[model samples]
Target: MRLPRQREAEVTPLHADAVRALIDAAAPRFRALYLLAASSGLRQGELFGLEVDCVDFLRREVTVRQQLIAPDDGEPYLGEPKTHESYRTVPLTKAVVDALAAHLEQFPADGVKIEDRTDPRKLHHRTARLLFLNQRREVGRRGAWSQVWGRSRRIANKALAATYDKAHAAWVRNGRTEGREPARVEVPDGASLHGMRHFYASLLIKHRENVKTVQKRLGHAKPSITLDTYTHLWPDEEDTTRAAVEAVLGDVPPLCPAKSA
Candidate 1:
């Protein structure tokens, strides 16, 4: 049966500066969480599920074996990763590693009771040192975490807007008439915790990372999924083609000699 094609939604990743602002504006308790989100391409659930043992400090990597699943009617529990590909070891940048180290020092890991649902046949209870916890020192619930993210986003947006206003005022006072006025910067309302994941993807793309590498980092099952989401972020083939041809032919002499003019 034929159906109307829906328009692909545009993905506007958080700008690098905005990401910094967001992290800066986030509560001290969650600063590392936001930084990790932007640095590692882990999903919210994976971040929620992280345990002290998941991180390998010497290796500079985090193992993704499980995720925190929050059900509507019941409590959050530990479950298998979304897919097999999701169970990967994601490398960490030095900056992220330092941030994590500082965070651990500031907020010591607490042993929390985790309900394990990884084995569907039987549920198990275990105490593990979770990486992040709410104010009550409990495993963070998705809803509460999202609310905190929303508050941080609003605070960051206001700070950005104020900075833009101050710059615009200065420009007007200086009577600068050179180029078009810079566009005002504001983190979009649509930006959410997931936007940090998109920001991470953009970072990989900016560094000219290959499709397969980006796919692996993001834990996508296939390269096609990565390309489908971020194809536009890649450099245009036309530009590369032109540059290649120019490099080869730019200094060559004309084949035919011209007559005296």
Candidate 2:
């Protein structure tokens, strides 16, 4: 008997405006984290695993040296990135660099002793100056991070809803009630922290960045994987074909025009 094929994962990236709102609404300590995630496309684990040394302010880049791995029965620890390609350097936009700088100024980095398991053969212990830490000033765990993200999402949604309410009121005051009431504004349902990574990929595609470049920036194992996931976001082939033909041959009159009624 043949097994059924699995459905592809849905890709619903946040719009630019929504990203801005979320970043603005995020808690001060985590605001830069959100911006970096959206800008760099680093996986959640990679973001958590960042150390002070991983970010180069002068070069405006963040190197992916390790990731935070949380096992079923133990605490989270530093480990190697998911794949060889994941160990790459991602460039940062000026805005992201500024935000990171401000974050560091507000909340200074602190050294923490954590287990390093980047190599499976040998586990090492080291004191790392982590870029981000939990409220307790220790290494952040997945569960705590998720909770904070959820709280931030809720705050953002409420702020968006309030803005919509204000706009609707203005529309009513302007005597423009010709149609049904506009629905409340909220971030897409089921939009999680991972959506920021998707947003980053969408931004790269929008800027006409080539597939190979996108793959490298996102640390995808292969170009095919990037294509498989983001093929739809690219310019439509049919539209490109028409544009190419139009460029070669100026607008041609229809071969057979319908007779005037």
lDDT per model, in order? Answer: 0.87, 0.87
Best-matching candidate per lDDT: 1
* Model 1 per-residue lDDT tens digits across residues 1-261: 989888687567888878998999998888998999999989988998899899998889999989988887788899999988999999998888888899899888968898998778988999868788888889877678779988898999898888888778877877867456756766787688889999999999989999999999999999998988998898765558778888999898768977789
Q: Give one digit per residue, the lDDT tens place, for model 2 in 1-261.
A: 998988697576787767878898888888999999999999988998998889999999999989988776788799999989999999999999999889888888867888999988999888877878887878777677778888887888888888888878888987886576656756776787788999999999988999999999999999999998898898764457767888888677768977899
The C-alpha stretches of model 1 lying farther than 4 A from their native spots are 177-180, 239-261
Off by over 4 Å in 2: 1-4, 177-184, 237-261
- Candidate 2: lDDT over CA atoms? 0.87
